[model samples]
Target: MKQRFLITILVIAMFSGCKKFLNVDPLDSLSGNNFWKTRQDAETYTREVYRLFREGVAIRTGMILVGDLRCAPVAYGAYPPRGDFNLLSSNSIRTLVNTPRIQGDINTYWQVHGAWDVISDWTPIYKVVQAANVLYEKAPDVAEADQSMSAELIRKYQAEAVFMRCLSYFFMIRLFGDVPYYTNAYNDVPLPRTKDVEVAKACIAELEAHRNDLPWTYEDPANRAVRAMRGSAIALEMDLNMWLAGIDEANKKMYYEETDRLGDELTASNAYKLLPMENIAQVFAGRSEEGLFEVPQNVNYGDVLGNIRRTFTGAVLHYPYIQLNQNSTKSELTYTDGYLKKLYPEEANDLRKKYWFDNNIYNEDGTMQCFKFFNLALGENNTTASLSNYFIIFRYAGALLLQAEALANLEEGSQKAEALLNQVRTRAGADLYSAGTDKNLPDAIFYERSKELMGEGHYYYDLVRSRKIYNPDYCYRPISYGNFVQGAWLWPISEKALVNNPHMTLNNYWR
Candidate 1:
């Protein structure tokens, strides 16, 4: 009789365990120990962190929360009952002022109060940063089979992490002036707010250093691994430098110079090109070219979240109405009399007017529904498809406009600026380029930006950089408070972050 040899495989699975598997003392958690060891491990871990980018930190909440749209005219606890949507009303008394809600509400204080509120809940982003930090610091020691390739991969991932960190800080400073800067994710010490000038300088330095390291393409050669590309970094650099230019005098000059240099680079690279005027909507229809970067959304992915404008502007306000079905669920063809009357182009031949807004389109029941935001397939109740379109953070159009703005600010002749502005307007099918006054070069650019980038969130920044008060009726009303400091454009720090971190200080204007 042959002796049968039985090989037993004992697989011990641990969830959220320590960094090391064998040294696990049973009481120690297994989650932290087993992170980012192999290429696959690093990729998987990085994907989870990338999901935050897909979810909305960079685009949806961050940009829309600051720009003009719907307004809340009533106070916080008033009869109308204001929430996030109504926070933009100037007269509203209810103040939940923070970084997230600063532009829209009263008491736009730039302490730690609201600043922290917006970003504190971004636990996933921080986790991604932490993972990336691990890859940055530890990936080299893996004694990888392909040494140079491994180091390059590690640097690419690290560059992404740095991009996200710097991007977050950029917004933080924009919303809430001086914010605590942390290079290491594990640091528990509360950091004092760095000056805006210093913050801009530091972020630009980081971006410039990592620009060459990022890959030009996103599609991974091995197995279709998606990651941030060099184009994304360049787009971010253009935006950061452009924004930084708006602050003070000397830094303004430096940033403008940088913006011109980067903008020229972006144009020359040929990696990104502007989408045609007709196909512009298709860019936002899904994953398309015009988007330098976008948060991915799908019904199956459980990432279908409503955009701020579509939620409030399309649903509650009448500009573009949401059509409803028999099930009481929102439909796509919502119309508003005000929006049509105010924004519609005078020339009937203008294709963009028809492309962007709704007309006399009707529903099955003969009810007139505006197709401005029509997405019947993705109703409110449907978890699979969301009405909220992919929020476009940086687009090729923005790059072109930034280039135009930079040129306008740098050059003496209005002809160059006018020509640059015309490039965008003419593409949009607007006659303003030919007819509009040349004297109002900046205003022309501003109006063109408002119309072209409408509902894409750029108005408030234009207002801030120009130092012009936003027209109340034309735009959203300005909210004010007694303690509110002038030029307190940034949001106050969140009350929570201040309580947690001791070294953090209130912004100068707010203090």
Candidate 2:
């Protein structure tokens, strides 16, 4: 595991000791000594952390794997029975989607991929967290040191950093359950796991306290909708609120209320909205109008590509890799007939059925691939025309669905919930559910979200947070939904994570 940064205090002390005792001007003062003394310094350090967050194994790839593949909600049939097994391997030629070995139990996770380099490398996330923590602690002092820097500007910088830490922790808990909480950059000792509920409470409080510091949109030159802003923080709060509702029974009401408030505030602003149904598929191409925060991946840097595209692209299309290549084992891309029907029911005519998934599901040749993030290689340019698809972290549709779920749970805003659900459904060219006819409005809201956010990586978490993935009989199960709720759907903390910090233990259920 690589350390993201040395302790800021230790570095300053070490450098200060190196200065001349006679007050002679030094020829080699470290640049880091002046780092937190200016606004530019704060901004520059932020870019590094954001870059690290993008490349981190857990963030870059784990989101799609846990949110979509691990407990797949659809039976994506494939030729040669492409395996949907979850492991952390770079062997993309025989990917988990293409060749699922089907080891679903905690005891058997090691048998699938012993090293577990990809998904299990949770350390990378800690790097980003540490960076944010350092920034959060130093920004205020930096502003105080510089006479020209305003306290307001410093607070905004601090708020964004806090949002980053909170965002990373939110996903950490979502993926690994309990995680060791850190605030300073130098906490290298092994720490015990903190209860997720407490962590969530702390994070949400921090976000709410500083929400006013950020703006609704950040289109500044250095960050044009690329970084965390007010809307991004609000969206995160909505997700955390919903997840807390499922985990913390004592505070369930509070969670719902905050969820409703944040959703309402974000919706009322009208800063972002769902695009027309026709452009839904193209939403993943990068800075679309509806995006709250999307991580850009430039093709020139040779990004790892999106898991949605890599896992869902069928062997038929010669995208990314040529059709002739032997690495053509893409089974986890197609959905079973029953799952397709459930996704877009008979009465509902979701345009997403065509825009997101392959329209011709009946084609036996197995050409039905998800078109959202497909990296089409123009045969003439030899990969020159192919571009990286942006990872959509937060969007308007997701925010609206979160609000609709909260309203449904309250059972007081049936009309508002229906309107919220309809905003997404109506855009998708889907038939709207009448408030009078829908008895289980809560389930309907959750289901509509499942369809709208299917391949974009929200379904599995949605099921777990709403306590819907616990039952084997749950209707959302794909054909290979094994060990669905034996462990609350949280992955075991890697052996490496434990070794790095021996005080930490495996997730409660896995232990």
Candidate 3:
């Protein structure tokens, strides 16, 4: 991550306008043309692009929806007394919407408007993509003091950009279903929305083509550390392909083949390894062995403050540590011990239960609040200040599970699937694998995913995708008999987008 600092300094040097370039005014602002003259300039721009990519991946919306932390209550017209974590609440109503739920008006689902508007609005992403495209197109023409090194750097930058673009599109497709797939930034007019399967395939192809260009290991200045080699890319590719396979038949076959190949590559590379259950919290507590890709958040880096995890998971009684001041409601009902017990009743002895939550509070007489995210001592200013915790986007455990699921789906009664499932389950201190025909492979995977990745924003996707396979009726349900029909699966398209893009079509579930 510290290598990124070199790029940051480069951005400041080129864009800072301190240098008198080509007899230009000394104090005049530098344009993109004036900046891309040297290898250093391109390097800095590429770093900034990477920084943005990291930010996009760690967005709270993706985390909240995927992690299964928040759910809509019965009053809002969802089932299980709460909506699944993956499904965003409709924007048609405001009162029921809360943190970890869709913010602003409910109509935003159909219209494409909200705090998330900046992200879904599609400006910043294109900017990053455009910068990457420019670097790739101009790298050959630029004269560098070290020509070979400069060209190699340019290639690396281009690969990173392509990886980021594919990643951005993957998230967009998951959230919006159909989105305009932009290959080149210059083609500005919004392209027609492609089917989700098509988009996933394109994303996979781009990752595969550019995988070799990216460096497997990056040197860290802080501890002279090295992390995220080629294995990381292969693991990510496997994950993306597995997701694509679950969506459709053609994609299923393509993704399965890719996953198998990548899985073998990952196993052969031996660069990444899973963390022990005892070490999982510490792994998350700081930087540990498990994170495949993560967004580094340093308190010194001004933009990286705030207890987003604590704020989302903590109850009001927990107060300041949880950022309770941000919300109006302060009821204890929100934190249901019974609900949690029900979720993990069978594994009470598991150490993860203790690591996953803190049953104590700081206030003189306060009840226990969720302290899974509290890291007071790691911040810069206050002991209770937000710590610089990197959000883990992908982990080796996820890879293991993905491999298991792929095997189960492809080959009937494969022992590999059960063995893989047990590996993760045993680590979590759950029941051992038995030699029996379990028809609920998806459910087993979902349960393991829920336990292993709680509060990480994967629950919603698991729930919705599982519904598509196991129970279709539960996939779409009426929000209320007359008020609105919040389907069993599929989030409503933001209404704000609909208002802006006439060509945008609402999902059948929403209409």
- Please state the error at residue 247 of candidate 2 in Å: 0.3
Best of the candidates, TM-score: 2
When summed lDDT is taken over every stretch of 10 residues in candidate 1, the lowest stretch is 2-11
Q: Which ten contiguous residues of candidate 2 have the minimum total lDDT? A: 20-29
TM-score of 3: 0.72
Task: Give the clash total for candidate 2.
Answer: 5
Using all chains and alpha carbons, the TM-scores for the candidates as numbered come to 0.73, 0.80, 0.72
Model 2 earns a TM-score of 0.80
Mark the regions of model 2 whose C-alpha exceeds 4 Å error after superposition: 1-34, 57-60, 73-81, 86-117, 144-148, 305-332, 362-365, 375-387, 473-488, 500-502, 508-511
Give the per-residue lDDT of model 1 (tens digit) for 1-511: 1111100000122112323211112221112343333565445445544654544364334334345432322212211122433444342222434434346444342222223244333333434444444445544444353344466777766787777666666655666666556565334344566787677678778888986787665553321113565666677777777766766665676676777678778767776666676666556654455566655444354333333322322332222233222233332223232433344445434456666544443222123333233343444454224344555656777777776777677765356667767777677776655424446566666666765665555666666655443444434344333333353455544444455455656545544
> Model 1 off-target regions past 4 Å?
1-33, 56-63, 70-84, 91-132, 141-149, 219-226, 305-349, 360-388, 432-437, 470-488, 507-511
| Per-structure clash totals for the candidates | 34, 5, 34
Model 2 vs truth, CA RMSD: 7.3
Q: Distance from true position, residue 349, model 2, in Å? A: 2.4
